[model samples]
Target: MKTSDFHYDLPQELIAQAPLPERSASRLLHVPPGDACFADLHVRDLPSLLRAGDLLVFNDTKVIPARLFGAKATGGRVEILIERLLPGNEARAQLGVSKPPQPGSRIALDAGGEAEVLARFDDGFWQLRFQVEGPLEAWLQHAGQLPLPPYIERRPDAADAERYQTVFARETGAVAAPTAGLHFDEPLLAALRERGVQTGHVTLHVGAGTFQPVRVDDVHNHRMHSEWINVGAELVSQVRRTRAAGGRVIAVGTTVVRALESALVDGELRPFAGDTSIFIFPGYRIRSIDALMTNFHLPESTLLMLVSAFAGKQRMFAAYEHAVRERYRFFSYGDAMLLWPGEGESGSGDLR
Candidate 1:
């Protein structure tokens, strides 16, 4: 499919700038399989839409304060967004400056300490070694700012430090949050458990590349950036058990979908811990998830393609049109969708 096939015009005002005061207060667009019409609903109604024995797999990757401001030894200003933390206080990051810094250049961090540019990659990431006194995570907690998505168009405030992360977030490494999971809170989770709905977790450290636009016209030509993932044996067994008991394995976010799908080897869901660059488009068969709960994605983005692959392209387009007409919020701090696999896909139909 062409990358342009996923394009949808979203009104600028509809892009959510701030999170709702309540996490589960966001809207939920329910897109069922086949010819069924879409249903407008609220995120709080999720428990009623799901079955007792069904499993909801969430991405527990925690968003970190990955954005930092610093200056080059030459006194040039620089902004850094850490893409991935490396061993020995080193990291791969994207740099924003008037000019790219060359190797061996030292940057004096605004929060204190320094970082030496060690190398650059063809894909726009730079390798830097930090000179912090303690653990890099600790230093970032004290000095770094929350890396909000570019679309937000606002500086990080005190509220964002808590609102941007999910209630289940624990494993820390992500530069961006698994936004679909952001709709879940303690009360809603308790409600789901009371309904006998099982829960599991997969960690996929979401990277800044998640926001990268699809540059290729041919969707197949696009390459996804690698993100670290860990799909543990317990979750794999939970999925199997859910299947055996005639229940769906619903993914809470695209990140969880990617992690679970990447762990599928030889037609079996296996435990996996590694970096994955898997690109899922319309033609790609998804064997991992029965349903998906995700936020609205940018036009022509890899995330849109992934959803188009799960749900039908035409259905997704129609759904987007409806969402726009209804003024549903979009992006990271936006409303969400609960989508079952399209007709002829790997999952059951009309889960409700």
Candidate 2:
């Protein structure tokens, strides 16, 4: 498939600039399998939409304040977005400046700290060794701003520090929040629990590259960004037990879908802990998740392609049209969708 295969028209005003007053207040577009039609619902209605024995897998990766502003010794301004933190006090980052800093150049941080540019990584990330007073994460927590997506017009404010994170967020590493999980609050989770729906968690620290556009026309030529994922043995067993008892494993976000599918080895789900660059496009076989609950995505994006792969391409496009016609919000801090695998798709069959 071509990258253009996923393109759709979205008005600039429809892109969500800020989060709603309440997380569960966002709209939900439920697209069932083998149908072009969809049902309009809200995030709080998820409990009624799903069955009692259904299991929801959520991404527990927490979004960190990764945006930083600093300056070179020559007073040249520089912006840094930490992509991944490495061992030995090193970090992989994207540095924005009038000119790329050379190796050995030091960048003076805002909070009376500095970092020396070590080298560049294979994937175009700059390696830096910080000389901060405390740990880099701690320093960032104090000085950095939340890394909001480009679509959001305004700057990150105090509300983003709490609203951008999910209720279950614990492991702090992601530069971007899993927007689908953002729709779930304590009340919503409690409702699901009371309805007898089981819940589990996996961690996939989403990187800044998630917003990178597809530069190539051929979908197969695009390369996915690497993100750290951990699908524990307990979750794997939970999924197996759910399947045995005739329950569906529903993924809360695309990150969870990728994490669970990447953990599949030899046609069965297993525990996995490592970085993955698994790219799911149309025609690709999905093995782990049964349904997906996710936010509407950007046009021609890898995320859209993954949804097209899970659901049928034509149906997914039609659903997007419906969302546009009804003026549903788009992108992060936007409305969500409950999607089931279409008939004849890889994830449509029963695991048992």
Candidate 3:
């Protein structure tokens, strides 16, 4: 299919400029697959709608304050975003500067010192080891700012320190927040736990590429961005046990789905920790995950492609249209949706 297949019109005013007062207070719109009818609901209705024996899988990857600005030795400005920390104190990063930074050049950060680039990774990526004079993690907390998406068109403030993260966040790695997980609070999670819903966690450090536009005319030719994911033995066991007991595995976001799917090697899920560039689009058969709870996505985004794969292309667009007509808020700080596999896309054993 062409990239234009998933295109939808959204009003500029609907793009959320600020987060809602409370995370759970955001609105939800539930749309059934292959149908046009959509019901307006609240995010708190999640636990009530899910069955008791279902396993709710959430991505526990934490977003680090990875956006850093500094100066090159020549006094030119440079913006850096830490993509991943490699072994031996080495780090892979993306650099945005007036001119490309050269190897062995120094980037002086505001925290009293600098780092020198050892090599160039790719087009705009650099591999550098820090001489921070202290631990890099501790240095970042005091120096870096929140890595807000470019579409936001504003500066990060105190509220973003808390509002931009999910309550379940634990392991620090992600550059971008798994926005789907942001809606669940302690109370909501507690309620779900009390209702006999089992929960499992995985880590998939979301990358900035998640928000990148698909510039290709043909969607199939587009290459996905690489992101790190870890699925431990414990998570693999939980998913298998859930399936054994005829319980559904509900993935919290597209990131979790990729982690779970990437771990599925040789027709069975296994523990996996590495970079995955898996891309899911319409007509792709899902090997795992029965249901998906996620937020409304950007137009022509890969996220829309993943959701469209689970729900049929026609059904998914119908749901998106309903959301637009109902004045539903869109993107990061916007509303959410609960979806089951479409008629032809049965997630569990109930194929139509």
Candidate 4:
């Protein structure tokens, strides 16, 4: 399919600029199996929507304050977005500056630190060595700002430091949050537990590339972004046990879906820890998840393509139309969708 196949008409005003006061108060559009019409509900209703024994896999990769402002030794202003942190206070990052800094050039940070450009990759990323007093993570906490999505017009504030992160966030690595997990709170998690739903965790350190647009006309020509993922033995065992007991494995976000699917070995999930560049579009049979709970994606994005592959392109477009007509919010800080595989799609069957 063409990249344009995933495009939807989302109004500018409908793009959510801020998070709701209550995490679980956001809207949820339920797209069930077959040709059933979409159901508009609240995120708080997830416990009731899911059955007992179902495993909801969540991505626990925590967001880091990765955006920083600095000036080159030449005094030209530059902006940095850390893509991946590395050993020895080094990192791979994307730089925003009038002129790209060459290797050996030093950038003096606004927060009283420095970074020396060590190398540049053909993909537009730069490797840098930090000149901080202590650990890079600690220096980043004091020097960097929360990197909110570009669609959000306002600057990141104190509230965003908390609202943008999920309550279950523990493994600190991601530059962006696994947004579907953002709607979950302690009370809601408690409710799901009381409903007898089981939970498991996967770690996929979300990359800054998640926000990059699909520039190719032919969807198949686009290369997917790579992210670090870890699917542990415990989670793999949990999935097998759930399937044996006839319970569905529901993914909380696209990152979790990617993590789980990438770990599949000969149609069975295995423990894996590595970087994955797997691209999911129509024609790719998803064997990892029975349902997906994810936030609304940008028009014509790779994320939209993944959902189209799962729920059918036509159905996703129709649902997006309904969301727009009903004044539902859109994007990272926006509402969410609870989706089951469409008829004839891989993993579609009696979910009960």
Candidate 1: the clashing residue pairs are none
Per-residue accuracy of model 4 over 136-229 as CA lDDT, tens digit each: 9888987899999999999999999999999999999999999999999999999999999999999999999998999899987888777999
Q: Write the per-residue lDDT of candidate 1 for residues 1-352, one digit (tens) a residue.
A: 6877787888999999999999999999999998799999999999999989999999999989999999987789999999999999999999999988989999999898999999999998899999998989878987899999999999999999999999989999999999999999898999999999999999999998887888888866777899999999899999999999999999998888888888887769999999998887776778888999999999988888789889988889999999999999999999999998888644321100
Model 2 residue 214 lDDT? 96
| TM-score for each model | 0.97, 0.97, 0.93, 0.97
The alpha-carbon RMSD values of the candidates against the true structure, listed in the order shown, are 3.4, 2.8, 3.3, 3.2
Backbone clashes for every candidate come to 0, 0, 0, 0
lDDT of each: 0.91, 0.90, 0.84, 0.91
Per-residue accuracy of model 3 over 228-273 as CA lDDT, tens digit each: 8899999899989998998889998888988888888765999999
Least accurate stretch of 10 residues (summed lDDT) in model 1? Answer: 343-352
> Candidate 3 has what TM-score?
0.93
| Cα lDDT tens digits for candidate 2, 63-83 | 889988899989999998899
The runs of at least 3 residues in candidate 4 whose Cα sits more than 4 Å from the true structure, single-residue gaps closed, are 346-352
Assess the local accuracy of residue 174 in candidate 4 as a C-alpha lDDT between 0 and 100.
96
Worst 10 residues of 2 by lDDT: 343-352
